[model samples]
Target: MSAYVSVLPQKIPRQIAGSKSLASMLPTMLSTGVITLVATAVMRLLWLGFSNDFFGAWMEAWLTTWPIAFPVAYMLRPMLNHVSRSMSQPVVPIALPVRQGLMVSDIPHAAAEATRIAGLQVKSLSASRY
Candidate 1:
């Protein structure tokens, strides 16, 4: 059992060598690729409406750019997830004590309250200590 456990980590990489992480990305990658292509096509159509020669020249450039952009957008999923999750959770607001609708911004008030509570607690504990 000990020998088998020792060799487990070495076997994991070999198992992953033939597998496809890229396959999991295909649906998402293709969707974004299509959207980019459509937006490019729309711009080309608008340009063609004004000037056909310029649109034809730019079409080849847009097509070539997509191959690079598609892979990059696919790879960016993990980073996007991290950024979104980090931003989504809200910061806990600090509790501020209010006195007669006024914020009690004095440190002494907190210290006094804590001392009073601790004194009462200590008295109760001492009464019960056995």
Candidate 2:
């Protein structure tokens, strides 16, 4: 039992190696790559102005900037997840008085109210309008 227990810790590295941390970092790498690629290229071009060696300068800047961006972006992932979750949650509909009557901005409620005021059933709203 003790032998088996001792082997478990030793096996953890093998598992980690198998998963390839690089694979996990792929999304972060790709997203940050695109952002850094464009940013570095544009900034270098703008600062130095156009040159026959633009491609060389862009590649150099991109390589240097990405090392910094990758770690920063990876570290920010948790905060990003939190923000995205909060933003993505179904917004609680606030009940507010319609100050200007129903603008097209109002949704089903506006349609229902119009249908009701017109002496037509809600179902009639879905019916063909001739």
Candidate 3:
């Protein structure tokens, strides 16, 4: 009906507003929470071994850190965005002169040493290799 069509657009604006608000706020809330939880747990565990009262300590640490982390995250949003943008750049392959000096082994640090010996610059994360 004509009446329904006119009313629909008006209602749509309210839906759009709600969706935009949630879209912007949800990521920040989730990242802040996840970061807070992990940071608190790791720091607390290191500071006060896995004592029986870990739950209490974690809650206390989270309460203390939340106030600080929330503001810092908001303040650092621009800087973080820039850093994230830079990190997401496509990886470029660099051809390094292969040195046959170091032996390649299944052990973890051996490969790192081999790369170092070869003077190769590798990405922290290899895309297709992983």
Which is the leading candidate under lDDT? 2
Model 2, span 1-130: residue lDDT tens: 4555444545334433445777778889999999999998889889989898888999999999999999999999999999999999986558954375546767877777888899986433545665
Would you give me the overall lDDT of model 1?
Answer: 0.70
RMSD of each predicted structure: 13.3, 11.5, 16.3
Model 3, 1-130: lDDT tens digits are 4556444445334433556757566667778988999999999999999989998999999988887887678778889999999999987667865455755553568877888999998877768777
Residue pairs in steric clash, candidate 3? Answer: none
The lDDT of model 2 is: 0.83
Query: In candidate 1, what are the lDDT values of residues 11-78, reduced to their tens digit?
Result: 33433344487557677778877877777777776766556476665567577767878788778978
Off by over 4 Å in 3: 1-19, 83-130
The Cα RMSD in angstroms, rounded to one decimal, for candidate 1 relative to the true structure is 13.3
- Judged by TM-score, which candidate is best? 2
Clashes of each: 0, 0, 0
Displacement of residue 49 (Cα, Å) in model 3 is: 1.4
**What local distance difference test score does each model get?**
0.70, 0.83, 0.80
